[model samples]
Target chain A: MKHVILGNGPTGVVAAETIRKMRPHDAIAVVGDEHERPYSRMAIPYLLEGKIAESGTLLRHDRNHWIDNRIELVEARASSIDADAKSVTLSNGEVLPYDRLLLATGSRPVRPPIPGMHLPEVVSCWTLQDARAILDRLRPGAKVLQMGAGFIGCIIMEAIANAVGKTGGSLTVVEMGDRMVPRMMTPKASALIRSWSEKSGVEVLTSTRVTAIEANVPHAGLLSLVYKAKNTKERVQVTFGDGSTRLFDFVICATGVAPAIDYLRGSGVEIGKLGGIVVDDHMRTTAPDVFAAGDCTESVDFSTGELMVNAIQPNAADQALVAGANMAGGAARTRGGLRMNVLETFGLISTSYGQWWGAEGGDHVEVVDEAAHSYIRLEFQDDRIIGATVVGRTHHIGALRGLIQTGAKLGADWKARLQADPNKFMDAYLATALSLA
Target chain B: MMNSLHIDASKCTGCLQCEMACSYENHGVFATSKSRIKVFDFHSTGRKVPYTCTQCAEAWCMHACPVGAIHEDKALGAKVVNETTCVGCKVCTIACPFGTINYVADTGKVQKCDLCAGKPACAEACPTGAITFVDASWTGLDRMRAWAEKLDTNAPTA
Candidate 1:
């Protein structure tokens, strides 16, 4: 058997290892678009914070780990795939044929349509190269501006804030959404995060959009001229929708990320509504002998029981395992993942489990302590905890996930108890889930 | 190498495979609640810290135990809880500053990382090499090597 895994990330690497484990003699090729060893993007912030070296970001510290496993680490951009031909064409003009193909080609940071967005100073904190660029540009007290406050944005924001604080630099975060993490978190939870950021000496601007970014170099009258000075290390200016411009040492554009599937444009594999490769529970795409996982694949949202992309590392591993097993001629099914997000912005911790936003007509219970920066909102579909959003609370996060994932129905009394004190999740779990077990 | 679990919290993914492995090794079933190791997810920043008892040389739990339930195993360098003697007073849980010691309600005894009697299951089960059983004396080897490598930056670029 031959397997060609795209993206060489957590998903692709895990799939390759599993394939090798299942079928030892199988030919495995793990292709990645990066120049360095396969590393985790999740560790980028740690690298930025000077906590871990670049090698620490690597998937495995041992250089021979891949070669020893007989997994070919091919560094090349995947140009396109001929599903009918069962071959993937690389940008380097190499056509690799595979008996089974896994499209783990994860997401690329979404570059907004703002002018002068492609300048060298304006970078997305998504890749290893991006982290290196950021580190190089960042010094103590260096003026840093991050554009976006989503999950990825907040992480980068925290890392940059830490880096800047050490250097006595200023940090500013601009989010176009009405609140931080608008898509994942509720308004109150997002507001709590913004307040937390502000408290941590971060200048957070929400409900604002950047219109254009330009260089303060000579002959840069318009955005195009500023973009023309893209290579210059000149001070950059960001123009807002309100027609006000602000200058920063460097800008990080963490606007968003989308499935990096432009090469799958004409591929027979079905694309989901969110531009992710749609895959079944077995992680198999529409095309036979072809599978998908990680940020690129749209798997089932265990909470909503609908097709959606939960692009977290754990989900990626789960999808990869299932996809690898089935590709290796073993029977396996992905139990799928809930929409779970746990973020630590600066020192404030927040978590959103399952369908954090309440379903229509769903009963919800909330407890807010604005002064202490603590908040909890539990959405119940009748007696079951369908979702929950918690801020500044970390101890019972596992229990919240347990209840949501298990679909544990709180008894009327327990539900009332929870409504009265949302912090009693551990007790609720002990009574409900443990009892049922 | 002195037997000690060198935890690099940065590499944790909150998979809880460690917790399951720990529970399975100790309790004969896969249960995180029964596991000695706990992975705490600090949600706001997306940091998953897998915390376990860092067996102190003069362990706090051992010192705080009323009935001398927490005993130090010299061979393994672990603070093994004598479950038979533990009355679950929950004193050791508070005495331990790291919060690694916990009182199990069912067992009515304190539980903590016993190093699996020298072969910690959590280290073996951690997918990301975040947790590793290493030489207790030189857990800083990796960090030192990192800085040492940086010092020779002008040497060459590969």
Candidate 2:
């Protein structure tokens, strides 16, 4: 059997290797559009911090790991899938036939429709090449501005903050949302992160948008310009929505990312509302012999019983395993994945698990310490713990995930006790789930 | 010089990104239960300690392996397990002072951290600069540098 895996990121790599393991003699081909080796987007922050080199971001340490494992790594962007012919046509006009195909094509950074966004200085910090470009523009005391404060944005901000802090540079983070990571964090939790950034001497502007970016045409000559506008001596000027302009040495756009499923435009695969390929529990798409995983595929959000894209690496890896197994004629089923996000920004950790926003008419508990920068919100449906949002406290993170994932019920008594004292979660778990004490 | 995983427990957030990366690299899965490097969460104290084999020079696991499956890779100073030679004896799992090595029921062999052949996934996946693969000889250098920089260079030569 011949297997073709698309995208070649974490999902693609895992799928290809899994197929090789299950069916050792089966021909496996992994296709990636990027020029560099398969690298983890999660590690890009470490690369920006100078903690690790470009090689460190690679999913596989050895260059020859793929070859050694009998997996062929092909560098090509799949233009379209001819499901009828069971062949994928590459941009270079190369056609490859496959007995089974896995579409692990991941996401592409969303470029907002702001004017002059295509400018060299305005770059999205997603790909390795983008990291290289950002590095090239970074200098000691560079005025760096980042847009968005979502999960990806916060991570990039952390790295940029570290780099700028070392050189005594100024860093500004702007997010159109009311707070940092608004989608995953509660209002109080997000405010805590903003306060932390402020305490760290970083300017964090929330509920703001970048209107336009233009070249900073100096009014005076080089010497006069440097002397007069010493602080705002950057090359590009950014116009905000509030009719204010500021010059920045570099601008990183971490606004968002959309699944890279445009290649399946005419592939007859069902695309979901979230713009991800719709797949069943077995990771099989509407198209026969075609499976999808990773950021490009939409599966069940276990907690909510709704289908949404869980673009996280762990979910992607899990989905890929099931996809590979079923593609190889092995029976496998995915229990689906819950929405879980754990973020560390400027040393303050925050996590959101399952439906962080409480279910409809559900009982919820909120423990907030604004001054301490600690907050915890537990959402419950009936007697079962459904979701949680924890900030500045990671001790109960694992236990919270367990309770939510297992759909553990905190009986009436335990629930009443938790409503009074939220810190008694461990006792509730022991009493309800484990039946201990 | 041999290197070790220098961990600053204070910097850990218990995110478990390291666990996912470790399992993916070694077992071809994202299950943290199969991960060799485990993050021990001290709930009451709110401390996260990423525990793994320190690859002691005088290794107890190596001495306790009945089938001589565990051998040190001199180049990396990591005691690697030869899966083919392992007899599922699990004697090394008990002999190790640190509960780092364990027996895998599926593979019927004991698995532990071998530093990923000098490139550990846990250290690589760490985001907060907490877990650093540093030179074993100077694990305390980073801390010492912070303290040394406070010296008054021109205060008094005498």
Candidate 3:
């Protein structure tokens, strides 16, 4: 039996492992659109700016996951699917049939229709190819303009600033938000980020919208940008945001991405409201014998149990394992993947697990350490640990992650313990890790 | 025989072992961002090259500093940063073409590779031997010797 899995992203990687463990005799093949081997796309900005080597982003750890699982990877895009025939047509016109099929088509970069956006310098993150192309032109003193305030946007902009600053490269970050991390951080938290970002010589312009993307293509000069603030809509020579016009050598669109479900469009696979394949708790699609996971599918959020598009890497991997197990004739169910994101930005590490909004509508606890330029906040309701955000000192994020994973209660003195010392919080994390609490 | 740290960018893996070791040796923290020596990753070519102050004897950074914060360490034959007198003006940072000297916001002072007073910690920590604390005057001696050995005068013309 040929086990054909669509998309070789994180989900497909884990699914292969589960399938190999259960059905060793069955032949496994992974189809992917990416030319390069599976690499950490999140780490590309760091790779581009010369913080981390590109090879490191290729994921050198646990080297034998694909080969050991006897998974044959086909590096080509899937054009379309023949659901009735249990076959998939490749971009190169090859059709491969499958005994068990898993659609992990993943996602692609979202390019908004804006003027001068079609230029070569206007880049986006869908692969390392774009990073490599941008890195080739990135030099000391080269100016950059970013067009989003999301996680990928923040990380890439930070990396660019760090890299360009390594050789005295100047930068400007434009965000159409009230705060740096509007969705993730509170106003107080945003102030802390704003302060830290300013100290690092990063010009973060928030609550401002980019109206146009100008180009100086042949001259290789900086790009001229126009923007107006959301509240005031005032036009000022603010090189940061509300400026007459600014110069930037290049522009990166970190806006967001959409699920790649073109293959399964006419295959009777139902897409959710978010344009991802609709799936239940078990990762089973509307069609029997067909399953989907990762950014390509609408997964149940373990935190809210709501059907959402959980495109984060961890959720994708967990769902793949569950999908593969059931496909390989094992009694395993996805049970939904958790919508969690753990990130280290500008020396400040933040982790979010479960519901960010609680009964009191995100009334949270915060510990601010001005001396250390650090802050930690935990959003919760009742006894359940919903969400957490931390900025500055991050010596013990792994331990904190364990406590969130266990869904452990903070006990009576949780607030005092957290504010007094991070060591106490670390102790709580260790206790959770040890399963003693 | 004044000595300096020689960097061979070709061999760098960009693992940042040098940065961590340098930061820990000088600042007592495993902070890469704070390190004087930086590894520049060229993602397109898949290259990681460690960069740092070359410690020139007639250091432009020394001459360019209005406050005379940079001076030659007679014993080590290396330019040492006098943090006490240094005003953190970043003039040296601007004057230096290589952009090695940088201002540390935490300490309100400019920091750069000081050759660990004589012995280099970056060279010691470099896993691939990309960096080495060799005699400054004869930095390329080892490469010369390797090439000299390969010149097979004894071998017949192939």
TM-score of chain A of each: 0.93, 0.94, 0.86
lDDT of 3: 0.65
In candidate 2, which residue ranges exceed 4 Å CA deviation? A166-168, A219-233, A420-431, B1-158
C-alpha RMSD over true interface residues, each candidate: 20.4, 23.7, 25.3
Query: Which 10-residue window of candidate 2 chain B scores lowest in summed lDDT?
Result: B149-158
Q: What value does the lDDT take at residue B113 in candidate 2?
A: 88
- Looking at candidate 2 chain A, the ten consecutive residues that score lowest on lDDT are A428-437
| TM-score-best of 2 and 3 | 2
lDDT of 2 by residue, A239-315 (tens): 99999998898799999988998889888999999889999878899999999988998888878778887667556
- Model 3 agreement with the true structure over A1-437: per-residue lDDT tens digits: 88888887657766776688678899999887777776656556557656556664553234575677688989898888777888888999999998778998888888766566776667786588888877865666666677776777766666677756745466677777788766656566667767776777888878887776655423222432222122111111223335457657677777778898877777898988988999875667887678887889887765676788756765665567667777887655555554455444565544444554444553556777765667777665554356666665433333344354446566555544554554455444423323222
Top of the candidates by DockQ: 1
Error of 1 at A339 (Å): 0.8
Candidate lDDT (C-alpha), each: 0.77, 0.76, 0.65
List, residue by residue over A155-216, the lDDT tens digit for candidate 1. Answer: 66777887777445788888888888998789998888888888888999888989989876
Ranking by lDDT: 1, 2, 3
